[model samples]
Target chain A: MRGPDAHGRFGPFGGRYVPETLMNALIDLEQAFRQCIDDQSFQEDLHTLLEEYAGRPTSLHEASRLSDALGGARIWLKREDLLHTGAHKINNALGQGLLARRMGKRAIIAETGAGQHGVASATVAALLGLTCHVYMGEEDMRRQQLNVFRMQLLGAHVVPVTSGTRTLKDAGNEALRQWVAQVEHTAYMLGSAVGPHPYPMIVRAFQRIIGKETRQQFLARCNTLPDVLVACVGGGSNAIGFFDAFVDDASVQLIGVEAAGSGLDTDAHAATVSKGTPGVFQGSLSLVLQDRHGQVLPAHSISAGLDYPGIGPEHAYLHHINRAQYVAVTDDEAMHAVEVLARHEGIIAALETAHAVAYVLKCAPRMPRDAHIVLCVSGRGDKDVSTMMAYKEAHA
Target chain B: MNALHTTFAALRKQGTVACIPFVTVGDPDLEVTRALLPALAAAGAHVIELGVPYSDPLADGPVIQRATARALAHGTTIGDVLQLAQDTRIDGLDVPLVLFSYINPIMQYGINALIADAARSGISGLIVPDLPYEEAQDVRATARDHGIALIPLVAPTSHARIASIVAHADGFVYCVSSLGVTGERASFASEGFALIETVASLTDVPVCVGFGISAPEHVAQFSRCCDGIIVGSALVRTIEQHSEALLDRSRRVQATRDVAHFLRTLFSQSSGGAQ
Candidate 1:
């Protein structure tokens, strides 16, 4: 309902906090985006690609059996898992890919934590015939090897980042560093609704299709907006995408679930909003996992995608303004929910999405039977098979 | 005048280009940093840049990143780095100390508090590599109030941005010669030389170039282009090769000698006044 002001600020949050070298580049991007974003031809071309190539308008299904098992709120699943590249990451990747071609950049660069974003970027790069390079943490690359191979097959040079925490944060840092040097000829295809100004706004605009579609589809199916919108928050793109259209609906509640890797009581967690302080990081002002001296702490999660130490600035703004309520779900809780969804709903959600399912399991029982909840299934759990196997092996 | 201004003014009068060396504080340990600062200063570092180790140094390359990791591994905080600078000052090291960091640590420390503590710690100025001048007004004002110069960075920039940076530049303007992040490179771009020229033409303050000047020849070549030269990753890489053990006092001593010798070599080869 409400967008960031002219400064790309959602209140005191988003701004282009970067090196002087990248300031002009960011300005150029902002100007380019501002000009072409509303142009009919640009939107048409982007829409055509989204529909023809990337598979837009993913289905909305009612999880009746899972709803029956939960025995309370009716559950509607917005299947972003069906998007090309098996995750909603392609939405932004494709959008940025088109923008990159429009800007006449020769190559595309991106940072990946879950590997989904990298895969999506690579997929788009291959489709559009742009050379792509992706920076992924060594740990994430090892765990998400399937996606890595997929990226390699798609002709992207995946650079393994071994610096910092060796996760999303480090990959992001490496990408930004690479972008600083190659700004004239490369487009940094940022994956999430995080980072500096314009990026958060641009990503949200591309992803807002989820909310826009959900509104139309749900109205046709259920005849009304759901009582609640629930989505996992790892840099908060899917949640922002899901929440943006319904943000003005006072009756609709937006719930963002953070990944609690072990538990919030322990050090191993990515529950940034729950445990972090406000600081400037990764080109934006957001709630970050940092120590007393503001050195960003490494975040952990079972899902590589949800292991980022920082959330998007708009999510922080929303949390600050009480527009949304944030909750933390432990890895164990999420895994159990993943199993429950598999057994009851015949759906295996990505561990990142399982966090929301886990939260719904906890909250649904308390809600009225008539109350409706829509869980944004941001991605399918195909990539998490190895993690599942490891969990199985360890527990066995 | 402040220590930074005084140092630059005196260096100008001496017709000598400043040899500024950067090292991550608490890189090996606080003791190593303490001894290293003075050694670098004594070896002809006109101004010493002490890096505040950040987990995510976006502008930094592998060399500095490894140094920061080593520093953080030993639980080195900004407070500890400030303590080291203060201790070195107490031990009669008179080099103008510039605390170089990303903005997060200073923001966490509270900008006003950091400026006050920096001044008390005998720190002369600050250089946040990622902090552009547009978002730096408040910190610059407070730093000025605290007698600490908030040094503005001039990357390889366009003419308009260069004008904006020079018009408001305090202390000395740090001109990054390389197109990329901090590291030693084999060669320089013609644009880098042009950037130094552009900055020098517009600014009264000393213009120092950093981001990839390693060898003594590089120092001599760059010294001819600007008022000063900052050696970062190459200098850190030198100590890293000798003192891998971080806590080994003898190894640290050897590394400190190597750095001092490195700076001495660079300065001895430097011919004269800024080009």
Candidate 2:
């Protein structure tokens, strides 16, 4: 298993691009992660928390009716949507919450996009009796108000960030800024497979269980690996979690679907891997949407979760090496996929996850009958009801 | 010594603190930025930091973020900011000027091109808030080739790594006053002083204290500990609040005067060089 090299380079992406104030914190976190990865007690504790607290070993569901409607490849869903807090974010949150406790940190600071990560972080912090503070963009606060209230109900302080774009990126800026002041006692529970070195590495490791389960469950049922693996990409935590387990299997083609708000041909989209160039943003060197002079361009997407200008560095590396193929699904297509799943398979996915579903809906119809595909249902659409209502109202 | 080293050395010889002021370029307007550079230099700023506006500035606090937004609102590109630096040079601005940009903007400008242009613009040094040692190797090489100083910043958390960061790194070391972005603070920890003192003791390169440097007392205190102090958010806030009414008119000289007077008062106390 070729892990990130000592310097934390994942094929020209992922490095410690951070303020010096947090540099040592990252090193400390990385050391803690490495130590705990091998400690039997730590492993058992995390495993127990995943099972007993976050309700892990999320089921792998065969969307038989939906697959039959598509009329081609057999489609399956890795039900992270069924995880506690209704998203895969809980997996990493619980793991990092444990790491923070191990490091003796009493406070956990996190940034949230769609509020799912915030709720997950707050859930773990509440469960462990740690002081929790989540920074969420003002724009996101409006888009995902329920999640904000959920975070607050969990006894976490939700700070509304009104900085640039007032979205995920801005929320991160505020979180990092606040972290600088309290690095002594706080652990930044970064919510995605992004940010500086050990964060992407750490988040990806915690999320690996998603794919690990999918692979095992698929093997138990279908007797072989799926021919194609699909997941949505934002900061790409859930995708990387699912993709990492299947990365080495050459026969399994990894597909990452990006949020295309309107269309990739237009400016309004978060198709970072498709449209972005290599640059440093937030923390890591990765594919980011930037103008000619290098100022980061705010990404727009109907789904707040996927509305970010940069993708995870590992995903960038994956796209660069042709290990994973990235495609864009417009808001209309994704919404349609949501409706299709809700009607046929009794699954209502987050708008972010619907992008992957949209892609499978289009592609499955043309694939061979026996072909199998595992799609990551990253989160439940309960948090996205407002967005769905607005779309319906606008269209009606 | 490079221009940064030479500037710090001269300040050290004078036994005075180098009062460095930072302002976002093209905030309100570039014409004002062009004028403010020399005004700040004449007003006791030993070195000037011209902030390049970026969409996302993680290392900054609210004041600088607003300043950046104002500058970016005016569509001030890095190239435009560099042109203003060149204009200041033509205006015979004598103080050492540095470009303070986030890595994304510099990467977009192309690292080598940005370095070459900075050298052309008579820029003395570069401070990338996000570019620490582990990831700065690429731009650091080109900056070295251009004789441009790549100022290294060491935070208090960077305890054991300080010696190595200061050893191979060029330019004066920036000692972050406390854990946080740039903003005024009531007081800093004693550990901050100890960190700066340790960094100062380790190398020939000068150590400068920055972040939360708002008060003149901070200048006097940090002056005793290191080679200099950086005054950013306070100066930026003054310009942002005062320059709004005078933006379209040259009467905005009030903002410049406000900045100059603020620095004058701050440094006048620091001339005693700490208690």
Candidate 3:
């Protein structure tokens, strides 16, 4: 939504909190990034990689049956789940991996929560022939064991971080530690539009491709942009991916749905933007669940991907600037949306993406009958099927 | 003015380059480090880069990493280091005391709180190796408000980026001897001297060479080209290997004195004069 000037401050949210040893390296990276991203050759190379390798320009499908089932609003889904790696994360991972190659870095490091980003990064690393290391929390490693196996199969090293709470936050912290130590020859491909300065900026730049494509596709389909745009927010990558292109267009309503777990009133939620206060965590200023003494609070959610205690810094900026509306969807509603999509469309969506589906379902009845809405089907339900089945059985 | 400024001025008056020794505080024990600082300053060290222990020190070599592990195991912290400086009154010992560290521990300590505590403890400067100069605005501003210098570093590859780094650096510029992490090497390469000259040409601030500077010849070579010589891994190695000799209360004070004396002698001899 906003660009960082020469200083890396996005309304005082995105300043660099890196160590001094890596200052020169960061400066070198900044300079190289400025020149390379602008060069036509670099752009062409990135486009070629996206098209030939990762399959660019994923389709936007209109869900007529699902819309008829709702009987309130017209619904369309931008099928990022159809993309390679079954999510929108490959776009950012490829961009960062290419940038690393251009910077002469031999290795890439990344952190994963639900392991979608890890799989995406590992895929890119395998294709690019760069050494890749993905740090995952011990708890996440256990929960997302399939993705962990997939990453390993792709020839990437998966290190399970056990410190802190042994979750996404701890994985991110461990990755940061590893990056600081080896900043000279290594590049940390942060998974989301989060972290400090250039990361939020860079990750968003990579993810903006999704929004760019969505704008053109939506315009082509409806002869205008959708009335409302919705996406799920874990670290807010997919939400920001679609929202970035629409921020300046005030007429296009951007709604970001966060996982509310059991309920927002309960501790079992990841509704940071809706319920938390502003603070610095993982090198960026954002709304985080913290105690009065500023200690980070434990976060919870039915979906492992949406279990983070904080949203991305750029999301915080967007919320502050009133450019986007952030809402929360409870666990029950999300499960219902999963079943609705599966029964109506024969497409089971990831639990994280179900949050967006749930939000639209809840809001659709209140909107005009002919209102057009676009929801980002951010990932597939295949990886999350086991968890979804368990939740359904428990509820039954 | 901060003690760092005073120390530089004093060194200039004596026509001598500053000898800054870096050591992880409480490497062997907190009590031993509490007794080591004053002895180091009294021996001839113009400035002290007192390292605060971090769990993961990526840029550090084997020697410093072991030292950090030891210090952290001993429960060394930013507050503990600051308390040592305050309790021993070593911060008032004329030599500038710069807190050397990675950023996470400092961020965990709270940037504002660390600056305030450091100022109260009479810390003269901060040298955060992991904090880039471009990102040091808030840290530099806080240090300046408290009259402490926020010294930034420049690596060998810091050619085109010199102007920005020079603009941000205070007290002095720490010129890394090589591209890799801190550790001992058999010989100092010509590239280190070239880097020293390059850094010196970019800024008027004193250029102190460190990283891989372990032996007398390395110090001698730096003495001929730069304004200061910093020995980290070598001293860390000495402490690690000779802990009993260095930590014995009767010999602990003398160990730092001997190292500082050795560094000063190497510098003076290389300059073809006596200090």
Instruction: Kindly report which residue stretches of model 2 are placed more than 4 angstroms away from their true locations once superposed.
Output: B272-275
In DockQ terms, which candidate is top? 2
- Lowest-scoring 10 consecutive residues by lDDT in candidate 2 chain A? A1-10
How does model 1 score by TM-score? Answer: 0.98
Worst ten in a row by lDDT for model 1 chain B = B266-275
Model 2, A1-396: lDDT tens digits are: 445778777888888778888988888999999999889999999999999887889999999999999899999999999999999999999999999999999999999999999999999999999999999999999999999999999999999998889999899888988998899899999999999889999999999999999999999998999999999999999999999989999999999999988998999999998999999888888999888888888899999999999999999999888999999999999999999999999999999999999999999999998999899999999999999999999999
The CAPRI class of candidate 1 is medium
Residue B218 C-alpha lDDT in model 2: 79
Query: How do the predictions measure up, each by TM-score?
Result: 0.98, 0.98, 0.76
For model 3, the stretches where C-alpha displacement exceeds 4 angstroms are A20-53, A64-72, A98-107, A129-131, A159-188, A259-311, A329-340, A386-396, B8-85, B90-95, B100-117, B129-131, B137-142, B177-194, B200-204, B209-275
From the highest DockQ down, the ranking of the candidates is 2, 1, 3
The interface RMSD values of the models, given in order, are 1.1, 0.9, 5.1
DockQ scores for all predicted structures: 0.75, 0.85, 0.18
CAPRI docking class of candidate 3: incorrect
Give a tens-digit lDDT track for model 3, residues B13-101.
Answer: 77676778788998898887766677666656778889887654556765786787688666677788888878767345656788886
Over B1-275, each residue of candidate 1 has an lDDT whose tens digit, in order, gives 78989988888888789888899988777888888887777787788999999988889889999999999998888888888888997889998999998999999999989889999998998999878877788889999899898888887755578898888888899888867889888888887889999998997989998998887778778878788889999988987876664458656677677768876876777867222
User: Residue A24's C-alpha lDDT in candidate 3?
Assistant: 57
